[model samples]
Target: MPTKKELLTNPIQHIDIKQHNVVPLVDAMANMAYSSRDLNRAAKIYEMMLLDKDCGVILCLAGSLISAGLKQIFVDLIRNNMVDAIVSTGANIVDQDFFEALGFKHWIASEEYKYGAHDADLRDLAIDRIYDTFIDEDELRICDDTTKIIADSLEPRAYSSREFIHAMGAYLVKNGKTPANGGADSIVLAAYEKNVPIFCPAFSDCSAGFGLVAHQHHRSAAGKPMVAIDSAKDFYELTKIKLENPVTGLLMVGGGVPKNFAQDIVVAAEVLLGDDADVAMHKYAIQITVADSRDGALSGSTLKEASSWGKVDLAWEQMVYAEATMALPLITGYAFHKEAHAARTGKNFATMLEPVTA
Candidate 1:
C-alpha cells in the first residue's frame, strides 16, 4: 500500500475563470445548436439579470462543485458583485469551501481509483473521495473541531444557517484566514466582505453537523446551553430578500435543496405578502444539471414546470441539461468577460436583512 502522502500529493488546483476570457468562445457557441445554444441563451439571460438594476441574482449551488475546482469562480462572482446572494448545500459551504479556508486542500484522485475500486484502501488511509477529488479525513476532523470551537464561543441560541455562516466569516477574519490576511480567498470570506448572505437549509448534513453534534452532546452532559441551527430562519431570511427585492434571478448549478430553496422563496414571498399574485415570480432563471427530468425529482424538474407552482417565470427561464462544470464557467465567463456586471451594483441584501436576522 502506498503511503498517505503519496496518495494525496497532487492538490486540486482551482479553476480561475479570470485567467481565461471565454467571452468570444461563448458568443461563438450562441450560433451552435443543442446544448450549446441553450448555454448561450442561459449566459445571455444571466447578463440580463446583471444589467437589471432592480434584479437580485441568487446563486444556488448543489453537488460537489468547490472540490471539483470551481471555488475561484464563485469567489470571483462574489467579488465582482455578479451574485447578490447564495443558497448552497452544507457540504459545499462547510466541508469544501470552509475546509479549504482552513488551509487544507482537496487532492486529485487518479481515474483508476474513482469507481469504489480503491475506496476501502482510501478509507483505511484516512482519505475520503468525492468522485475525482480526495480529501484528508484527518484534516476534515480539524474542520469539525473548528466548528465546535466556534459553536462553543457563541451564545446558546438557535441561529439560522446564515447567521452561523456569518459567524464563520467573522471567525476567518479574526483568525486571519482570509485573502487579505495572506490566506486563501474563500466563498465564506467573500460573502462576508461583500455583505452577501449565504443560506444552507440543510446545514447539519455536513462536517459542521458532526461538530454541532459533538458540541450539543458536550453541552447537554454539562447541563449547559448549546447553539442550534434553525432551518426555518434560513427560509424566512431568504424569503425576505425576495419580498424586499421583488425582481430576482436564479443561476442554479445542479439541484437539490439549494435549487428548491431558492425557487420556493418566490412562493414564500407571495405567501408572506398575503398571497400577492402580482408579487412576481423570479424574473429570470437558469439551471444547469445532468439529471434527467424523467426521474420526477426536484433536480430534474423543468423551469417551465416550476412556473406551474408559481416559482419561476417560463419566459426568461432555461434548463441547460448539462453538467455544472461544463456549463457554469461558460455562462459565468461570458457574463464576466463581456462586462455584464458593469452596470450592476449588488443589492447588498445581507446588509438589508441584517437587522431582522440579527
Candidate 2:
C-alpha cells in the first residue's frame, strides 16, 4: 500500500490545462489529454449520467442560482430533458420570479462595496435605480393574488411541489396570464411539457410561504381548519421518488437546504435498491459551490462523505468549486450543444466520453 505521505505529496495524476474560455474548456473536456485529468474525468461522469437509460431522474439542488443569473441554464436543462426532477432552494425560485417580474439585472459590486460597514444597505442602494426602471407594487400585488389562487385550489391531501406548481400554472393559463413573468407559469409549463417532477422539500421556505399564508386566510374565511405543512409528507415523497428511480444523478449548484435535500435522495435510493440495482444508485453527481469544506458547512460537505454512505458512487462523482453563475451556463450550453450535434450527426453523444470507473 502507498504511504499516506506519498499519497499526500503525489496525488493521482490529472490532466492539466490553463484556460478560462468555454470553447477551450469544452474542447479540453472532449480531448482527454488536453487539460486537468480531474476535470476530464468529471466531464465523463456527467456524460455517462446524461446517457444512461436507467438514469431517469436528475436532481439539481442549489442556493441562489437564480440570483446568480443562471435561470437560462435551468430553462435550457428543462428544454433539453436533462433534468427529470429538481430539488432547489425557494430563494432561487423567488429570485427568478423577481427577475421575470421586473426584468431585473445583477451587477458585481466592488470588494470595497461588499466590505463596507453599510454593506447590508447596499441592496437598497440600487432600489432607487430599480424603481426608476420598474415598480414593485404591481409585482407584490400579483404575487399576493397568485398565492391566494393557488392556496384556494390546493387539495387537502399532500401534494408534491411539482404538482402544486403545475396546478398553479394551469390556473394562470386558464385566467389568461402569460406564463412568462415570475409565476408558476414557467416552472409549471416546463415541467408539464416535459413530464418532469420537481420536489422542493423545503417548499415553505420559498414563495410557498406566501401561498401558505393565503391558505390560512382562506381557511379563516371559510371557518375551516387551517392546514399546516407536514414535514413528514415531504420526507416521504422524497424517499418514494428515490426508490422509484434506481439510477439517480444530482447536480447541486450551491448549498443550504437544497444541498442536503438532494444528498438525502441518493441515500434513500441506496437504501431502497440494496444489492439488486444494477446501475448503482446515485451513480453521478456534480456540484458547483463557493463554500469551504474545511468549515464543516453542510453546503461544503464533500462527495466523499456521501460515498461513505453509498449515497454517491465514489468513482463517478464530480465536484467543481466555483460560482453557479459562472459554471452552470457553460456546462449546460456544452451539454445541450453536444446533444444537438449528436442528433444531427447520428452519433451517440452521451457515450462519447466514458466514465473512468475504479
Candidate 3:
C-alpha cells in the first residue's frame, strides 16, 4: 500500500456558486424534459422562497454533502440570508463542517482505491472513506475530543442540539477557527453568526456521540453531573419556528431525519395551537433525491404524500428525482445569480428560542 501522505495529498475543493452564475443554464432547463424540467421548477420555487419576505426557508441536509465538497454552497446560502434555519444530520455539522473548521481537510480518494476495493487497506491506514472522499481517522479522533472539551466546559444540563451547536460555533470563534481568522468558512460558524438555528435531532449519532460517551463515562466516574442532549427540546424549539413563522419553505437535499424533522414541525405546531388546523403547512418545498418512492421509505416519499399528513402543501411542492451534487449547485446558483437573496434579510431564529430575562 502507498504511504498515507501520498493518498491524502489532494484535498477536496468546495464549489463556489457565487463565482459561477447558473441562472441562464437553469433557465434553459425549463425547456428540457424529464428531471431537468422538474429541477428547473424546483430552482424557481427556491427563488420564490427567497423573494417572499414572510417565508422562512429551512434547508435540510441528510447526506455526506460537506465532505463531498458542497460546504461552500451551504456557507454562501447562510451568509446570503437565503436559508433561515437548518435541520441536518450530526455528521454533516460535526464530523464534516466543524471538523474542517479546525483546519483539517477531506481528501479526494484515488479512483483505484474507491468502491470498496481498498477498504481493508484503508482501515489499516486509519483512513475513513465516504464514497469517493477520504478523511483521516486520526484527525476525526481529534474532532471527537474537541466535542468532549466543549461539553466539559458547559454547565451540566440538557441542551437542545441547536444550543449545543451554537456552543460549537462559539468555541470556533473563541479559538479563531473562523474565516476572518484565516480558517475555513463553516456551516456552524455561519449559522451562529447569522443567528440562524441549526437542529440535529439525532445529534448523538455522529462524532458528538463518541465524545459525549467519553464525557459521560468520565463525569459519572467522578460523581459529577454530565451534559446531555435533550432530543425533545430540539423538537419543541423547531416546532416553535413553525408557530412563530407560519409561512415556511423547505429545500431538502436527500432525506432522512432532517427531512422528517422539518416536516413534522407543522403538525407539531398544530398540536400545540389547537386541533382545528391552526398551523400552516410548509408553503413551498423541494426535495432532490435518487431514492425510489416505491420502496415506501420516508426519504423518497412524495411531498404530495406529506400534504396528506398535513406537513407540506401540494400546490408549491416538487420532488426532483436527481442526485444532490448534480442538482444543488445549479438550483442554488440559479437563485444566487438572480440575486433573489439580496432582497432578503436574515431571520434571527436562534434568538427567538432563547430564554427571556426579566
Candidate 4:
C-alpha cells in the first residue's frame, strides 16, 4: 500500500486544443467508415453551427470530463466564442471545474489502484477516485467551504443555478483565481470573463450541495434567512435562451440530465409560446456517446427519437457513437483550426440572460 502522497503525485494535464491543429486528421476521416465517418460529419455540423451567424451554440456536459483532462477544451471554447451557453451536470460545474478554479488539481492514479483493490485504503487517507483520477478529499472540502462562503455573501433568496454559477465566476475573479492573476484558467472563470451562461439544472448534487447544506444549517441555527437553489428557475432561464435565440445548436458530450435538460428546453419554449411557436426544436445537434439506446435511458436515446418529442430536428442531427474523451478533443480541435471563416461570434448570452456580472 503506497502513501496517498506517492499515489497522487502525478496530476492530469488538460488537453489544449489551441496548441494542436487537427484539421487534416479529422478531414481525412471523411472517407472512413463506422464511427470515424460519423465523427467527421459531426465535426462538420459543429463547423456549420460556427459559420451560421444566427445560431447560438449550447455545449452540454456529462460525466467526469474535466477530471479526465478535457477542461481546457471547454475553456478554449468559452474564450474563443465557439460556445455560447452551457448546460452541465453539477459535478462538472462545482466539484470539477469550480474546484479547480480554486487552484486544486485532479491527480492521476496508477493502474494498480484503479481496480478497486486499494479503494478502502484510499478512503482511509481522504482520497477520492473518479475512474483513474484522484482528488484530494481535503481539497474538496475547501471547495465546499468556499461555496458556503459564496452563499454567505449572497442575499438569502432562491437563485437559479445560472445566477449562482455567475456568482461563482465573480468569486473567482475577486479572489484572483484567473490566468491573469497567475492562479489557473478554468471553465467557470473563462465563461465568466466571456459572458457565457452555465446552467447546472441539478444544482445541488455536487460539492455545492454539501456547502448549501452547511449554509442552510448555520443560517437556521442563527435564525437568519438562507440561500436556496431554484431548479425550476434554472429550466426557465435556459428556456429563455431558446426563446431569445430561435436558431440554436447543441454539442453534447455524453448524456444524462444535461442532455435531457438542454433538449427539453425546446419543448418548454413551445409550451411558453403556444400559438406563436414555430415548433421550436434545436436546429443543429451532435452527441458523442458510447451508450446503447437499447437501455431505454435518456443518454442512449437518439436525436431522431427526441424529434418525436418535438425537441430536436432530425435533418442536421448526428450521433457519434464514441467515448467523449477520445472524440471531443478531435471535434473541438477541428473546429478551432477551421474557425477562420466562421461568421458567428460570441452571443454574450449571459448578459442577455440577466445582468449578473463577475
Candidate 5:
C-alpha cells in the first residue's frame, strides 16, 4: 500500500488564463458546429458584456471547480474587472479557495485511487476525495477551526455570507495570509481587494459550517450570543444589486443554487420594487454544463426556460453543454486575450451596497 504522503505528492496547479491566449482557437470555433459554436457565441457575449459599461456581470459558480484547478481563473476575473459579483457554492469559497489561502492544497488523485480502489485506505489516512481531487482531512479541520476563530472574534449577530466572506478576507490580510505576505493569492483575497461581493446562498454547507457549529455550541454552553448566517439577508442584498443596476449579465458554470439564485434575482427585483420598478431582465447570459435538461434538473434547465419566468433574456443567451473545466478557460481566456476588460472599470458593486447592509 502506498503511503498517504506518496499518494498526495502532486498538488493540483490552478490554470492561469493569462498564460494561454485562446483568442484564435475560440474564434476558429465560431465557424464550427454544436457546443463549440455555442461556446464561441458565449465568449463573444461575455466580451460584449465587458464592453457595455452599463452591464454588471455576475459570475455564478457551482460544483467542485476550485478543487478541480480553476481557482486562479476566478481570481483573474475579479482582478481584471471581468466579474462584478460572484455567487458560488460554499465549498468553492470555503473548503477550496479559503483553504488554499490558509496555505493548504488539493492534490490530484492517482488513476488507481480515482476508481475507489483505495477509498477505505484513504479514509484511514485522513484523506478526503472530491472526484479525482484529494484534500488532507487534518488540514481541513484547521480550516474549520480558523473559521470558528473568525466567528468568535465577530459580534454575535446574523450575517450575510458576503459579510462573513469579507471578514475572512480581513482575516487573511491581518494574518499576512496574502500574496504580499508571500502566501498564495486566493478568490476571497482578490475579490476583497477588488471590492467584489461573494454570496454563497447555502452558506453553512461547507467547512465554515463546521466552524460555525462549533462556535455556536461553545457560545450556547457558555450562555452567550453567537453569530449566525442570514440566508434571507443574502437573497435581499443580491436582489438589491439587481434593483440598483438595471442592466446585468450572467456567466454561470454548472447550476443549482448559484445559478437559480442569480437568475431569481430578476424576479426578486420585480417583487421588491413593485410593478412601477421597470427592471429589465439580464441583458446577456451564458451557462457551461454537461447536465442534460431531460432530467428536469435545475442545473440542466436552459436559459429559455428562465425567460419564461422573466428571469433571463433570450435574445443573447446560449447554453454550452460542456464541463466547466473545459469550457471556462476557453470562454474567459478568449475574452482576456481580446482585451475586453480593458475598456471597462469594475462596478465595485459591493461598495454600492455598503450603506444598505450597514
Candidate 6:
C-alpha cells in the first residue's frame, strides 16, 4: 500500500480550508460535502467572462429571489451591465410589487404562532405575515384599468416581463395611483431603464393575479377578452432570440421551472453543436439551492450532470448549497466590484465564446 507521505506529497488539486479563510457559512457548506471551492472558482471564471467583450449576453434564472430579498442584487447586475437577459418566476415579480406596494414585511413566525398551528406535524419554518392591512378590492380594479390602458397604448404584440411591468407602472403613475410610501416601482421600471429583458413563464403568481381578476371583470362588462394575449408566440420569439445569440450563461437562484427552462436551452444548443463541439455553448453556470440531491431530483443534481449534457462549462460549473439570499449578494457584489475595478484601471475585459475546434 502507498504510504501516507506519498499521498501527502501529491499536488493539491482542490481548495482546502487550511489554505484560505473561507467564510464561516462556506465552512458549514464544506462540512456538508458541498462544493464551496467550486463556487469560488466559478466566481473567478465569471469575472474572466465579464472581461470578454464577445461574451455579449448573460442570462440569469431567478426563482423566488424577490421573496428572498435579493431583487437589489439582480438590479445591481443590470446596472453594472453584467446581465442582458433574465428568466424568472412570476411569484418573485409579485413579491417585489407586494413589498413595494404596501411596504410589506417578511417575518419569522414566533413560537406562539408555531405552537398554535393547525398543521402541527409539518415542519414550519416559513416566514409569515398578515396581509390584512393592505387588502384593497380596488387594487384588482386598478390592475384591470392599467392593463386596458396599456393594451390601448402599446402594440398588441406580446411583451417581455420588463416591458409589461413598465407599461403598468407608467399607467399607475399617470392615473395617480400612488403605491404606498417607500414601495418599489416594480421590477418593470428597473428593466425598462436598463434595457434588459425579463421573461416570466408563470405570470399569475403575484400582481398578475390582480391583473387576471381585473381582466375577467372587464371581459364580463365589455363582452370582450381583456388580457387576450397568447404566450406561445412569446415563447417562440424568446427561442429565436436565444438561437440567434447562440451563447449564454446561466445563474440559477433556485430550482423548479426557471432552472429546467434555462437548462433545456443549453441541451438544445449542445445537440445543435453535434458530438465534437469542444467549446461549450452554455459557458458559465452557477446554482444556489436548498434542495437535497440524494433523491436525484433536478434541484439537487450536481453541475456534473449538466456538464455531461453540455449545459454548462465543465471548468466553470459552480454549485453553492446555501440560501439564494445569502449567496447571490456575495457573488453579485464581487462581480460588480470587479467590473468597476476593471473600468477604473483601464483594463480590457471580454467574455470567451470561442469553441475549441479540434
Global Cα lDDT for candidate 6: 0.52
Number of clashes in every candidate structure? 0, 6, 0, 0, 0, 8
Stretches of candidate 2 above 4 Å error?
1-23, 29-40, 98-138, 179-185, 226-228, 269-279, 340-358
lDDT of 1 by residue, 167-276 (tens): 99999998999777779999999999999999999999999999999999999999999999999989999998988889999999999999999999888887876853
| Clash count in backbone of candidate 3 | 0
Native-referenced Cα lDDT, model 4: 0.91
RMSD per prediction, one decimal? Answer: 1.4, 12.9, 1.6, 1.3, 1.4, 13.7
Give the C-alpha miss distance for residue 44 in model 3, angstroms. Answer: 0.4
Model 3 lDDT tens row, 293-340: 998999999999999999999888899999898999999999999999
Model 4 over residues 1-358: C-alpha lDDT tens digits?
7887888899999988889999999999999899999999999999888998888999999999999999999998988889999999999999999999898999998888788888899999999998799999999999999999999999888888999899999999888898888888888888888889999998889999999999999999999999999999899998988888899999999999999999999888888989576856889999999899998999999999999988899879999999888999999999889973355579998887656522
Total clashes in model 6, counting residue pairs 3 or more apart in sequence or in different chains: 8
Give candidate 6's TM-score.
0.67
Per-model CA lDDT versus the true structure:
0.92, 0.55, 0.93, 0.91, 0.94, 0.52
Error of 5 at 230 (Å): 0.4
| Native-to-model Cα distance after best TM-score fit, residue 229 in candidate 4, in Å | 0.5
Q: How accurate is candidate 2 locally (lDDT)?
A: 0.55
Worst 10 residues of 2 by lDDT: 10-19
Name the 10 consecutive residues with the lowest summed lDDT in model 3: 349-358
